[model samples]
Target: MTGHRARRLTAALFATSGYLATIPTANWLTTRYPAAPVAPGVLAPAGVYVVGLTLVMRDVSRELAGRTPVAVAMAGGVALSYWTANETVATASAAAYVLSESLDFAAYEWLRNHGFTIALAISNAVGLIADSILFLSLAFGSLHYLPGQVIGKAWMTGAAVVLLLLRRRAHHSGQLRAPGFSGATPKAVGRPMRRDGGGHDGFGDRAGTPTHPQQNETASEAMP
Candidate 1:
């Protein structure tokens, strides 16, 4: 493979690996530590912080690896959770992971055309809320941890979004090359491409410059 393509593949694999690892890591954390208090009277899983990072990584995995592979990774995560966590935590995690991820996937896909940052923020918000409610209810048989869960996940999501926005801004400002869903490094935003597919060379062709004969042909006439 070309060096660029190989690099892209490597990045995708790394993102997928991170996504797969987060679930089991969170499960193990819950198994190892006592519940942490998030509010005066509320207690959330000690793994809440790691699970928050998992949501952000999930979206990144989808961007890099595409949908089907991410689905398989989700299954792998569920299996790992079952092995690493208590039966109740595993069951609750599985249910919440499947349902909340589905909601996140759907919302992200629908809003993706709007903008990456906007879609990510909204989808993560939806997923976080659904995950907190379902997992807390199923695992503890109550919503006592809901507030803590939401607050923790929101902090992670907001921080992740901010970092990504800064990265994109750097790319747009010609300070970096951003990897995006297109599998190509993005060109600096607002810079036009030439007809020959190179960076813009000049403001415009000389006023009387001869144009390619093909350029003068109408679109319908040029078709084979």
Candidate 2:
């Protein structure tokens, strides 16, 4: 019933829905152009996954006060899988996804803990490049039917831009603020509060003022 609890629930629901949507969206896109060139058709699913992952991870990063590098890596992996239609390519894509995403997660965590924003930015950029290379090499390295490598590279670049921009908007909007810890709360300092129980303030506090001690205590205990 509380504002914070509602925000958390909403965030959780959004994440779950977005994750579930990935499968169907990818499948639909892949099937739409079953006979077309893989590169072009693949872009559909890849674009969707990129947009969804960016929005989801933006909120996650804001809530956690850090970036979710695994999400970005997963975006690359998913794009690769959808692009590659072969069984062997699929397997390789899975492995690449797992490994790259794991590494990205670790790298992001390290950078965050060390207060290295620049390092985090650089690492994320490099990771994106590495993921794209590994994915393309595994999925389409042998294929000559697809257009020049530049096409795929361009797709990757575009996806990265979309993700970064989404992240920036989410951060600026304070959509990533954890439940119960918003501008309306006494503990919140810089962020502005929203009237409808969303935004930086989350839901309206029961008292219609800053959060009370009990609310703060509850929120603190829930921190991960």
Candidate 3:
């Protein structure tokens, strides 16, 4: 694989790991602090805003791993959360995550052709809404944490925007390839290279008369 492709695969796996990790992390945080301060005036379970983190992570995974790992991550996150979290919380988490991630993937695909930032921003927004509402409502059967949930997750999304800007800077600096969800890299156009003799341009043909054409003719003549 090329350097660019390798970078992407590593990034995708990293995001996937984060996605899976949020399951246990959120579980632990919620158990530790049923009401944590996401904002000065807003209190929510520490786990509430992680939905936002997952939203952005899903976009990165989609960009690199495409639909397959997204699906796998969702399923694996749910199954793993069951083992790592309270049964009730696990069910709520799984249900909300699957629903939100599905929408996130669809939104990403819809907006992808426009641009990476546009797609990621929109998808993260939508996913955060779905996950926050569904997870909170199902887990707690109340909207008391809605404000904190929104604010915390929004902060995370804002962070995603910054991360995206950095990614853009890296790409423009030739540290990475253009980010895309198209699942294909742009083919690089290259000048034909010369072999032992050198190139026809500056390196290949060093003689007054070109020898490649003559050699081909000579080989054909000798063969016949």
Candidate 4:
């Protein structure tokens, strides 16, 4: 297979693996301990799952050279997370994870396709709004005795915004250009050279006369 195809296959496998791993990790965390701060068992695994999935999606996007599929994959992740959990909190958390992740993917793609500085700013802002609403609502919305959802949402949103900003600043800027050629501009194959020593111009001429001086000189000289 060609190199691009190979890379795309590899990326798809990696993304699938990461996505599968995230489901159990998120479930395990929220279920094992039904309390605040959850536990290291839950939080650590969930955190790792989120980060890993994010990385995988990013890599896949890079490999595919597009953002739409990546966005769709992220949306799938959220749906999967929602389905995996049995409890309300767990379900909420899973749902939150999905929303937050999908938003992140969208933002990331937008920034990638657009200018880094502006894209980063716009995506981060939008991501913060989405993450805050989804995460806080899921994490604290069901808890009766807890403070207002807005309070939690605000804090989470602020933290997420900071993190996104830092991440954007730290990472190298620019979107990944897509691989493979389209029908409109397929990659050129072997080019033909003129017998007359003219440079190749990409067109092959099977019937063109020899243009070389030696061939022509002999023909003309011999002709009297």
Candidate 5:
């Protein structure tokens, strides 16, 4: 492979691994430690923090490798949980990941073209809430952790949003060379990239249909 392509793939692999690792790590934390107070009168599993980070990790993987890799990583994460956690925890985590991440994926896609940071935050919000509720209910048969789970995950989500803001500022100020935190604009799932590096729908002029011969060639070159 070309050096550039190889490097991109390597980065994607690392991001995907990070996303998958959080599953077992959260499970381990949950088993090793007891529930703790995350806010006034609100208790949550020790894994709350790690699970919060898990939402961000999935976004990074999706941005780097596209949707397929993220989907695969999610599947792999569920499988890994079975090995790392008890059957109850494994099943709960799997169910939560599938349902919540699906919601996350949709929200992110709908808002991504508007702005990456906004999309990330909003999507994480949806995923975190859904995951927390489902996992807590399924595993513990209660929602005592709901408040703590939301608060803890929000902390991580806020941190991630801030980091993205800094990355964009640095790039714009010429202190960073990458066009995005991922080193490039994220490719839209199942769409050809434009010369301007923006993802678009597969319909209409902005959908990446070449308006000129030069545009046609540029579109081809833009494809990863």
Candidate 6:
């Protein structure tokens, strides 16, 4: 597929996955895993969920489709989550995503020059903090799960960093596209071609060089 098309498909896929993660899926290993508390009553392992992928990928989506797609994804995710997860959870999740994703997008724009992983890492960190606070406070009425939430989301962000790293690898490997979905192969951004052949640019050597009448006229009067 073309570069942009690949990037779009990737963004859509990741966005959907992040949204779908909202609905708690049954883990065959452990059913309805309650807060097992990772630390000494600090937080429960069950509370540590991998739902933050939405925020992470949302940042990636921003780079691909800019702010519009990211906002739309957040809205679409919330709408879908409403039917899948409980209304309370969905509301809280949607609000958290909207606030956090928007923040992430803005931050990324300024910090992205450092690198993809670095940019997403920083943005995702902010997003996770916001999402954790908002969701826990609004949905559960308790920050008891905040620590666990952060931990859970950290894993998701790490995975996103890996993806960014991969994309950078592809970019360095000569893929001129920004790794999204699109129509045709994208042309690489490159430097302009130079007319190195014998031509009097009117700045330097004129011997054995052909010069245009307009250029020669301009140069002769300017120099003489």
Query: Which structure among the candidates has the greatest lDDT?
Result: 5
lDDT of 3 by residue, 40-145 (tens): 8889878766766777777767666777887888787778777777777788888887787778778877876555677788887877766778878887889898
Candidate 1 backbone collisions, by pair: none
lDDT of 2 at 86: 48
**C-alpha lDDT of candidate 2 relative to the true structure:** 0.43
* Residue range 101-145, candidate 2, lDDT tens digits: 566566654554322232334444445545445545665554332
Q: Write the per-residue lDDT of candidate 1 for residues 81-149, one digit (tens) a residue.
A: 888988888888889999988999889888765556677789988888887888888888888778888
Runs in model 5 with CA error above 4 Å?
1-3, 175-224
Per-residue lDDT tens digits for candidate 6, residues 1-224, read 97746755776666655544443431110124535554465663352445555565566555555567556666665676656556666677667766886777777767665445567788778777886788778777888777877777786668767775665455434422334312242222221111331111111111334544344334323321
All-Cα superposition RMSD per candidate: 10.3, 10.0, 14.1, 16.3, 7.7, 13.7
Per-candidate TM-score against the hidden true structure:
0.75, 0.44, 0.73, 0.42, 0.75, 0.61
Question: Could you tell which candidate, 4 or 5, scores higher by TM-score?
Answer: 5
Task: Give the winner by TM-score: 5 or 6.
Answer: 5
Clashes of each: 0, 3, 4, 2, 0, 16
Instruction: Count backbone overlaps in model 3.
Output: 4
Task: Name model 6 segments beyond 4 Å from true.
Answer: 1-48, 170-224
lDDT of model 6 at position 87: 66
lDDT of 5 at 25: 83
* Model 2 ranges with Cα > 4 A deviation: 23-89, 113-123, 143-224
lDDT of every model, 2 decimals: 0.70, 0.43, 0.66, 0.42, 0.71, 0.54
Q: Which ten residues in a row have the lowest lDDT in candidate 6?
A: 197-206
